[model samples]
Target: MSILYVDHEINNLNSFKATFRRDAEIYLAESTEEGLKILGENKIDVIFADHQMPDMTGLEFLTLASNQYPSSIRVLLTGNAYTDEFKRAAGKGYFHSYVNKPWDEQQLRKLMISNLR
Candidate 1:
């Protein structure tokens, strides 16, 4: 499965790539625009976006993505424990799930594997 990860921090992006590179085809983007571009060009199966981006919030990007590519599973990653925001997004059908910034690698891997299936 192909997965796209969008984050402003290079290190975070790098870490994600390193963590999941062996598991799937990984695409990395540093901005929403870049992520959108990648989405347009690739058949992404899943997408994970950092919530606190500089230009657009991850939910905003995921909302656009949901309209453009509804089949791709969306996931939000946030540093803050904003359950209300996460719940609202999920209720709106913008994202399938939300992950904390310092996420458990095993749980995330499992989530990705299950969603891809």
Candidate 2:
């Protein structure tokens, strides 16, 4: 499956590629605009986005993506402790799941596999 990860941090994007490159076809973007462009050019099966970004929140990006690519599963990666915001976004059906920053790789892999199935 093809997965897209959107984050402003270069290190996080690199680390995600290192971790998941063997598992799936991974695409990385540093901004929501770049991510949207990638989405337009590719058939992404899953999307993982950081909650906080310079231009827009991950939720906003995901909301836009969900509107355009309803088949792609969306996930939020957040380091913050704000469960309320996460819950609100999830409740609105913007994303399928939220993974805390510094996430467990195994758990994330499992989640992705299950969703893909």
Clashing pairs in 1: none
lDDT tens readout by residue for model 2, 1-117 = 999999999999999999999999999999999999999999999999998989999999999998999999999998987678778878888899989988889989998999998
TM-score, per-candidate, Cα-based: 0.95, 0.95
What's the distance in Å from true for residue 91, model 2? 1.7
- C-alpha lDDT (0 to 100) for residue 5 of candidate 2: 97
Q: Please write out the lDDT profile of model 1 over residues 34-104, one tens digit for every residue.
A: 99999999999999999999999999999999999999999999998877867887998999988998767
Candidate no. 1 TM-score: 0.95
Give per-residue lDDT, candidate 2, residue 106.
93
Write down the RMSD of all candidates, one decimal each: 0.9, 1.0
Query: Candidate 2 at residue 62, lDDT?
Result: 96
